[model samples]
Target: MATGKYISYLRVSTSRQGASGLGLEAQRTNIDNYLNGGQWTLLKEYVEIESGKKDDRPKLQEALQLCKATGATLLIAKLDRLSRDAHFLIGLQKSGANFVAVDMPTANELTIGIMALVAQEERRAISRRTIDALAAAKARGVKLGNPDNLTIAGAERGRIAGVKSIKSKADVFAKDCIERIIPLRAEGLSLHAIARVLSKEGILTARGKAVWTACAVKNVIERIEGL
Candidate 1:
């Protein structure tokens, strides 16, 4: 039985889908099902219309910030709704916000890491296939460069900037948590005890989960000690 505050994030790939509530409704239903029997509070819900290929999701950034501030877990109906890009997903793991996919409630860092590698490989394969197809088209005298391509390039640049900005903010939040952990350790508290103290004090883990484990507490300590 799960118990905590949650921030739900839902996304759809196109404006049509968003407007028609096509994919959005199913996502909402899945999330509703997951939280049905759990003693939890839904702090907020953010719905976004955006492609998974881009990581510059404004609503997602807002959800993460809220998670960091309020110690609320990020809940999504599916992993793909969160992101299909391995690199983005990996970055999210370090973003100081806790997230769970309704489709894979038991997934942990190890499971996500393996999924990240596979997603990365899949992205590389797609890139290779696209390049090959483009070359073949060019060989056949088909025009390739266009204003649309330039627009896409510009969007990609914006996505990179947005990702960096969000990461910077997340790093600041992480540093604050580490600072708090260091002082607690200096007070002669063991990792397990420190975790309990943090929870009692309403200090959440990186993922915004109220409960903390010794390993999680140790990770914060190690992160700070490593400089």
Candidate 2:
């Protein structure tokens, strides 16, 4: 028996996303048109709501599995629509699926590899900048922490806790020992207090355990820095 032809994958980063944006609807519309345009057969369609920064998207993973199992080509509306993880994309490339990002018709393995490397480097640069900014803030005596650490009448504590979570990918851990002091410092609590409250409330870490530390918390904050 012949296997199915094309498999489609769609994703949205946040739960609040609508059914229309992020090219989700556009993909379905275009792929459907492609099928009817008389050259392709539709095998499966997968839709997921998860951050591109995280690796936990079940539907996307399912689509990849289907591609591997059936020897089908995976068609996506865009390349960046895949997760931001270079390692994950590289793994997919090794799986032998012919992936076509709708936006780039001539894209091939070599181009994809180069793109992944660039993405990884971009992430590293952002991380370096964040560290430098934090260090400078601390040097200037600015309180760079979550408002949860402040008292009703005293200065905020130096230590803070943060959590950076991607829907299904890597969760980094860091401790920002140097934080700048922000305005209204005493009016709000620091991240440490907030984390403590969360820990006491039994909020599990990204690894699904009950743990809270300054490094873990900092990782979470840094992960979502620009967004």
Candidate 3:
């Protein structure tokens, strides 16, 4: 059972939803269900519109500050209800406020199945990238059926260069996410759990995909290991 003070925070995408209390009531219901039998105090509830995506959410900051000052947990209906911004995540860590996502109470076997599905998607992405690269090369007038080893060697060099280019961008893009991911990983969160956390934080894969998959988390973990 939940015990301690909690300050509930809710969010919606547009001002219309916030004004109409369209999404807020559902969030309230979820929070109520989580605290149904718990001997806990619901200290306050704050609503914010988008974390501003620009990270301009005064309400989130206000709720976080209250949580910090009172030693209360920041409660929410879902993780994504919070900003999907990585900086906000980093700030939340620095603020020293605890939080609970009602919908994500714990991990389950379904996550393993999700990891497999994500892996399948990754394979498709690889095949798609290969096809795209070949088409791009054809457009650039590269001879596909070059009988000479020189052409083959040149193609190999292009492949390596392409790989380097993607890795460089991925490394740059993943910098902030790595900072958040490494600690969660060290603290014993499973890869899928980390994936869920990142997805909720609005941290996308290097390819800019919305959801983070276990394989994506593993790729970042491998990068950390390489470091």
RMSD of 3: 18.4
Tens digits of lDDT, candidate 1, 115-203: 78888888899999999999999999999876554687878987899999866554555576675677887899898998897776545
Residue 122's lDDT in candidate 1: 87
Worst 10 residues of 2 by lDDT: 172-181
lDDT, residue 68, candidate 1: 96
Model 3: per-residue Cα lDDT at residue 66: 97
- Cα lDDT, model 3, residue 65: 93
TM-score of every prediction relative to native: 0.58, 0.58, 0.45
RMSD to the hidden true structure, all candidates: 16.1, 15.8, 18.4
Please list the residue runs of candidate 1 whose C-alpha ends up more than 4 Å from where it truly belongs after superposition: 80-83, 140-227
Q: How many residue pairs clash in each candidate?
A: 2, 22, 1
lDDT of 2 by residue, 1-227 (tens): 21348898765564333222334567667665545554566687766666666656567678888888887888776665553567556765666787766656577888777777877887789899999999999999998866754664333233221222333234222111112212212447466764664455333344434445555555566655623
lDDT of each: 0.75, 0.58, 0.71
Candidate 1 C-alpha error for residue 50, in Å: 0.4
By summed lDDT, the worst window of 10 consecutive residues in model 3 runs over 107-116
Candidates 2 and 3 compared: the better one by lDDT is 3
